[model samples]
Target: MSGDLDLELDPHAVGERVQARLDEVERAGGPAARAAADDAVRELMLLHQVALTRLLHGLTALPGTAAALPGLAADELVGGLLALYDLHPVPLADRVAAALPRVAGKLGREVALLGVDADGVAHVALTASGCGGGCGGSGAAAAEALTRAVQQAAPEVVEVRVQERAAPAPLLQIGRRDAGVPA
Candidate 1:
């Protein structure tokens, strides 16, 4: 019985040692560093998964044991592990807000590259000269042409009306919409 208890405790000790090694590897930086970090992370993740599975099995075998098995929630445990590696989830709204400036800059570059005046109108210009009749079209026509070209180039992007803000640059809102759910 004592030997069985010692054997049962071995995984926890092994898990702690693996986690410590993972932390060390993460601190080192380079190509070799990344490989080491990946190996350590993989080992720790597997260990954690196995530990949780064993814990669950133990809980099922003995009814009140579940309540005593390290009260930390799954999210809390995962979040803690991620934080150790300087990782955390970022909200989509925050990401979009952060990305707005970069998007606006790219838009400005595209406009300038195409020799278009930024007077609330869009234009399209091919890289090659004399291609597609040199974009000699009306502003509205050019705007539509540019829109179609952009859509073709990057089909993932879609234009949608958003709430007007005081800022000149438009803000992107990225998230899914479920009825009656707060975004």
Candidate 2:
């Protein structure tokens, strides 16, 4: 019991490791064995889904129970369950908007959501905060950071495009002499 209690695992990390193991088995076991394994995994996932659904129903029926939970933990648990059932109440756009702060932290700047296109492309604009001078390397790093954040937060997003804010155009003198002649 102590050994079991000592093992702590992140759900996402466990899923990734399980997937890699499945791929290995598939490679070694051929098509028939791989198909059998796939079926087993699918059945197990369904069982897990049913259990979660029942637990959620009970928790939600209990007044004030869910509200008593901490914000982040509740969000993570609900988000995972919703994603599993394809029933997330928040739209993809709003989800991306919520993820901007963490992405901004990684980029060392503020990020604004431009919107998601019909093709599942996420458009984000980076605000010039700590990013002074705006060198090419820094721009690339910012783009990569936003991409990583969006991908993790919203896996349904097929791509991420970082839009550079347009620079202010140089002011033009309207006076005839100033417009046509040098100072």
Global lDDT of each model? 0.42, 0.72
- What's the C-alpha lDDT at position 136 in model 1? 38
TM match of model 2 to true structure = 0.65
Q: Per-prediction RMSD in angstroms?
A: 21.3, 5.3
| Position 181, candidate 2: lDDT | 75
Model 1: clashing residue pairs? none
Off by over 4 Å in 2: 1-3, 6-8, 68-82, 87-92, 105-110, 116-121, 127-137, 151-159, 167-183
What TM-score goes with each of the models? 0.25, 0.65
Q: What global local distance difference test value does model 2 have?
A: 0.72
Structural RMSD, model 2: 5.3
lDDT of 1 at 120: 19
Total clashing pairs for each candidate:
0, 0
- lDDT for 141 (candidate 2): 81
